[model samples]
Target: MFSKACEYGIRAAIYIGQQSAELGRRVGLRDVAAEIDSPEAFTAKVLQQLVRAGLLTSVKGPTGGFELTAQQLATVTLRQIVVAIDGGDMLQGCALGLPQCSAQQPCPLHYQFLPIRDQLNEVLRTHTIGELAGKVHDGLGFLKQFT
Candidate 1:
């Protein structure tokens, strides 16, 4: 359960990575938003965060937008994007959203949820954006509508 910003950031990064990896195409904010089915303005803000995090590069004026380097496309993982946008706190926070939840003072579901969080972190850590994009590029994945 990522924040809305984090959700958009993951989708936008994978989509941008796919465009770069598949066609060497640079993506505009509007096109990225439409492709990911996110709000243009909010997506713009989320993209700026990714740019600041060094997960993406951007330029202004004509022919300027956002893109990932070839190396980044192949290596940046979902955990990196989520942490950059959502912070490390996201991985450690209470699944039940309880302020005092922890191992010492566990929430109703804290013990049950901890393993799920750990598994999620491992999965996110291992899955590269390129892998997810590869799925879309190879017709094995769907970002929004199948295409």
Candidate 2:
């Protein structure tokens, strides 16, 4: 599963993508956090990581904030966000915390979970935040109808 930071990071990325697609311009963090319901402080920290990882662009001063760079818009996959916040090891490491657990020496859940894990990782690696936004923008199915 994803951590709160990872969840927030994804939400932040999605919000930025939606704004960029909707307004055709860069977006600010205070606005993004407010739109996504993430804490401004926590979202700021995640935004810093995203900027450092080259997944986002940040400007300073009165008009400064954050936006995804062109290269980032093209290539910044969800895996990068997950690694930036939670580390890639969370995906590849032993699920049971077995020090030496691996494909050869399986954990209890390895057989059942490894395939699912591999599929999930592939999804993260293959999809960009922009690609993900298309899914979110499609509307939240029945969930949106309620609110």
Candidate 3:
């Protein structure tokens, strides 16, 4: 239940981390967007958010691009990325987008969705980018939809 921007941000971070961890390579915006199947301009904006969050580093000129240190690549979690791009409200907001959808006067699906929301938050909070990327790298999982 994330925004498309948030989704691409997560994927881009994971792919960038994967490249550094697996290939020891730094990635440019075009390459990052290509790998993640995200739009170039949209991905650029998303990457800008990550860079602003200090979760990624970039260089401007020729032979310049983006890269993360091993620790950064390994330790940044999905939760961090989502929060960086979309804010905590994306996870903590009302499921129905209602302003007052809390337990006091719950929405129709509020109770049913609370546990699922908690589970997703925990999963994102606990799982590091490297761990998730490693799954794809090892063929235990995949990031690409069709491939």
Candidate 4:
């Protein structure tokens, strides 16, 4: 699982990517936050982290907004976004929250969880923002819960 900030970061990135790639427009912070159903202040902070990590670009003005280039949308994997917002520890940390869990001194669930973790890492590494956004653009995916 990801932290709240990271969750919002992923949602924000996908929304921005969708707008940029599908709508061919940059998105304002207000619009991004509204689309993701997140708080503007918190989303702003998360967006800053993505911008600092070079995952998203920001501009300031009436027409300025956030966007990812085509290259970025195509190449920026979920792993990179996760790392940028949550660090690499989520992929490597023990599922049981043991401080010293490892192969040499495995936690009770470590071995069992290893395969699951490996699979998650693989999916994150392979799934690009563009792929996810395209799903939304194509109406095959929904970012927010539907009533």
Model 3 per-residue lDDT tens digits across residues 1-147? 678999999888888888878888789999989888999999999999999998888878887788878888667888999899889975877788888899998999899989988998999899998888788899887668783
- What is candidate 4's local distance difference test score? 0.94
Model 3 weakest 10-residue run by lDDT: 138-147
Against the reference, the lDDT scores of all candidates come to 0.89, 0.79, 0.86, 0.94
**Per-residue error at 118 for model 2, in Å?**
0.5
A best-first ranking of the candidates according to their TM-score comes to 4, 3, 1, 2
Per-residue lDDT for 60 in model 1? Answer: 88
Q: Where's the lowest-lDDT run of ten residues in candidate 4? A: 55-64
Clashes of each: 0, 0, 0, 0
Indicate the TM-score of model 4: 0.96
| Model 1 misplaced regions, further than 4 Å | none
Q: Which candidate wins on lDDT?
A: 4
Model 4: per-residue lDDT, tens digit, 1-147?
Answer: 899999999999999999999878999999999999999999999999999999998988988999999989999999999999999987999988899999999999998999999999999999999999999999999889979
Q: In terms of TM-score, which candidate is strongest?
A: 4
Error of 1 at 85 (Å): 1.8
Off by over 4 Å in 4: none
What CA root-mean-square deviation does each model show from the true structure?
1.8, 2.4, 1.5, 1.0
Evaluation by lDDT, superior candidate among 1 and 2: 1
